[model samples]
Target: DTSRPTDLQRLIDGIIDDLIALEAPISGFFEDVDQLKRLRHSEANDYYQQVYGLEQRRQAYLSRLRTQFVTRLGIRTEQLMRENEQRRESIRRTTYGRVEDCIQWVRSRLEKLSAMEFVEDLEQLEGMFEEHKVDNHEIQDFRQNVDESIARQ
Candidate 1:
């Protein structure tokens, strides 16, 4: 008995929520329209004007929503790219950096390096490159340099 009849109940919660979220006016659709409808049909121009106003407001809100969405998407894409670059650097430090240091040490003492150790180091470095999907001009040049060093020895 406490509940109002369905016909008397308010059903504009969705519109109210949007108005609150977007800080937009109702565009005189609810409170003013009923009074407008009560007027004679001779004033049909008033009804059309109100409808047009509402349409304009809706379109403006849609434009704002789309702009905000695109801006957020762009920010997220840039963030993801930065995260990927960071991970690549971390991998390089752990994999390529360590291997490069070992290779450099071996090169510095090539005269004392055992043939087996040199071959093992070369293979390990190559494996590290392949495993990490490294593909760049610098890395390619380094690989070529390693091959040439081994050939010369």
Candidate 2:
């Protein structure tokens, strides 16, 4: 195999194809992690679980590849898998930070609402929600509560 250049080239091509196939799932996992930031709070947990499942699958596949393929092929697949894991972890941290910020913003808005004049506070809260693009059932329910309180006043 070493003396025959064509046979060696064919072996390299097969290894390259296997490497590309392995990378496809990693790319998909990256996309899923990136998308977590865009999802609403209500949808985040389910999406996170799905992504976590994918990560588990990817880890299992990588472990198999490391043992069965990388060792025999003399490839750098382990390094690539490690880098992907790092990227996934970084994205997860960013997603959690964003979710925490959203929660804090909602809490602060509610606190401000409690201390302000009714009509003015309602308008301000509405504006804040609109500006932040926070359209969720919880915020809507809060707005409805405020409106009912205003009507009673």
Candidate 3:
């Protein structure tokens, strides 16, 4: 079997992928003291420092990522705001049209009613006192009391 040179790129890719995918108690593998402790042996102390530097780079990348996320969010919010304004105007037009239609229907129906018929319909209100359980005699007494009080004033 032929021996191949060490795949440094593959090792770096695997490490970066692991750092990105880390979660929970294993989060920030490069920053974790316990994980870095393994690389801090007398022979590899310099390597540990390099790993610490990589962690700082990851933090810088995270800052840039947040900026990009905010920019995209602002653009989407502006687009949605414009869309909502258009929708509001459309709803206002629809509501006005519906109100006008209702008014026309009511006017047409009222025009069909004769004055005598309308008067008869209004005269039915005379019975509402009993329907509402209100005594007409008590109302007359109250009205007389109010008239006397107003005269005194």
Candidate 4:
């Protein structure tokens, strides 16, 4: 009976040792899985941060390009405005010079004409009129000619 008890105690101790051995490997497997999960989470975080950085850089580059384009457009517009003003001033000067020349030519022609010739021209103009009824069309044509000459100047 003493031998039987010793055999039973030895069998129970062996079973306990087997259970501890199995638990050691199982616990190690759980630890390995936890470590893998942490690593995967860290990798995902790093990838997201990289993508965010790239997006920020892209936005900055586009903003700079937009600013450069706007600045160039403004400069071009100012140059065009200056050229337009210069052209207008040149046209004004040319028109002024032409009007001055026309005035001088009229004064010279009036100075060259004798008083008798001027009176004779006036008499001829009166003779062409019909009994105090002047032709409105002829007057309009003369006015249009004067207007055209001034415009040409």
Q: TM-scores of all models?
A: 0.24, 0.32, 0.27, 0.29
lDDT tens per residue, model 4, 18-110: 543443454354345435434544454344335435434443443343345434333234643563466456546655764665567556545
Steric overlap count per candidate: 0, 0, 0, 0
Per residue, candidate 3 scores C-alpha lDDT tens digits across 106-127 of 5654564333232355547665
Clashing residue pairs in candidate 4 (N, C-alpha, C atoms within 3 angstroms): none
- Candidate 4, position 56, lDDT: 42
Per-residue lDDT of candidate 1, residues 40-122 (tens digit): 24554466456546655754554443345434333234643563466446435545544675487557545433333434577
Cα TM-score of candidate 4: 0.29
Better of 3 and 4 by lDDT: 4
Best by TM-score: 2
Order the candidate numbers by TM-score, best to worst. Answer: 2, 4, 3, 1
- Where is the poorest 10-residue window by lDDT in model 2? 144-153
CA lDDT of every candidate: 0.46, 0.56, 0.43, 0.46
Give me candidate 1's TM-score against the actual structure. Answer: 0.24
Give the distance in Å from residue 93's predicted Cα in candidate 2 to where it truly belongs: 1.5
- The residue-level lDDT of candidate 4 at 7 comes to 65
Among residues 3 or more apart in sequence or in different chains, the pairs in candidate 1 whose N, CA or C atoms overlap within 3 Å are none
Candidate 1 positional error at 41, Å: 7.0
